[model samples]
Target: MAKKKKTPNDKNVMAQNKKARHDYAILDTYEAGMVLTGTEIKSIRARRITLQDGFAQIRNGEAWLMNVHIDEYAEGNRFNHDPLRNRKLLLHKKEIKKLQDAVSDKGITLIPLRIYLKNGVAKVLIGVAKGKHEYDKRETLKRRDQQRQIDRVMKRY
Candidate 1:
């Protein structure tokens, strides 16, 4: 019998909202499928996507991703989809209910963390987050600075 080698993940991340992690405390994360057009997928494949100001909302028992901008494919021409259109997120009914309940609480929000392809399918990592206060954000910055200083000191030894 021949030995098989494991392949590393080569899926390219389309876009990531790094600010979301810095500005918000993520309580839970869920991977949900995104409904995209053919051109949209092509655009995503080319990494022409932005998730800086994107969010997820549970409406009418379904999840919708809003403000996710996928640029038009240069080769698609007239068949290209809208740039900032709302895309539906595919989640199970039970998971949707859970997310809706968590979102209903005060001071909690739905933030899109990143968009990536898993097994050739587009998936969005949605985070259940709570906005951080100014002092909290400052504390995070302080800790990060302290950690950097410690790393520098250790590297010199």
Candidate 2:
């Protein structure tokens, strides 16, 4: 009997910021738990979340996630949470301090990269990113195109 090949488990990604890599240079990443309402979680599980314009802010020694859109649940009626309310990010004191220091520097900001479920719990992947110049963005695009060409050539073999 032939053994079956093992496949990696599928990650339940709720939302992603597709433009993050194009707009900034990611320096460091951190995973954080989100404080969500019952309806908010259901909406997220249904993939009704958007992270394109989401960002993290460290204020008063705590971290908060802003601009992440979690659409109101269809059946929630009056119980649905606000779609644009700021959500608190659960992180340790040490991590919060690190984020605060990084964010205090010019051009350095905390951006939400993606949101996914881990062990049935919702988590946000946040990144410390530096804003890229126009030339840097062009260079990144050029490099990506060159890599794509190389991949195509290798696949032809």
Candidate 3:
């Protein structure tokens, strides 16, 4: 008898913020647990989420994720949570203090890069990033264009 090929089980992925990496220089990354309501969790599990305009902020020694939109579950009733409400991020006190100090050093900002489900719980991967200056952005574009050109040349050779 032939053995059947196994299918890899991947945790559900909700959303990603691709532009954050392009526009900011990522310094540090942290995986934070998200506080979610039943409806929000359900929505995330269904892959109904958006992170394009999402961000993170440190307030009162705590990390709060803002602008992440988890659409209401299709079957949700009046118990649905607000789509754009600020969600508390679960992080250690020491991590919060470290992030706070890093931000105080200037040019550092908290950016929510992606949101995914791990072990059936939703989590957000946040990064400590600094905004890239115009020159840096231009250099990135130049490098990308050069790489594309090199690939094209190699393919024809």
Best by lDDT: 2
Candidate closest to the true structure, highest TM-score: 2
Residue 109, candidate 1: alpha-carbon lDDT = 91
The TM-scores of all predictions, comma-separated, are 0.90, 0.91, 0.85
Looking at model 1, which ten-residue stretch has the lowest summed lDDT? 5-14
Give the per-residue lDDT digits (tens) of candidate 1, residues 1-157.
Answer: 9999533244657788999988999999998998889999999989999998888999999999999889999999777899999999999999999999999999999999888887789888899999999999999999999999999999999
RMSD of each: 4.5, 5.0, 6.0
Q: Which stretches of candidate 2 lie over 4 Å from their true place?
A: 1-11
| Candidate 1 vs. true structure, TM-score | 0.90
Residue 22 C-alpha lDDT in model 2:
90
Name the better of 2 and 3 by lDDT: 2
List clash counts for every candidate, in order.
0, 0, 0
lDDT of each: 0.91, 0.91, 0.87
Minimal lDDT window, size 10, model 2 = 5-14
Give per-residue lDDT, candidate 2, residue 75.
Answer: 92
Residue-level lDDT of model 2, residues 1-157, one tens digit each, is: 9999532234588888889999999999999999999999999999999998889999888899999999999999887799999999999999999999999899999999888898889989899999999999999999999999999999999
- Per-residue error for 120 in candidate 3, Å, reads 1.2
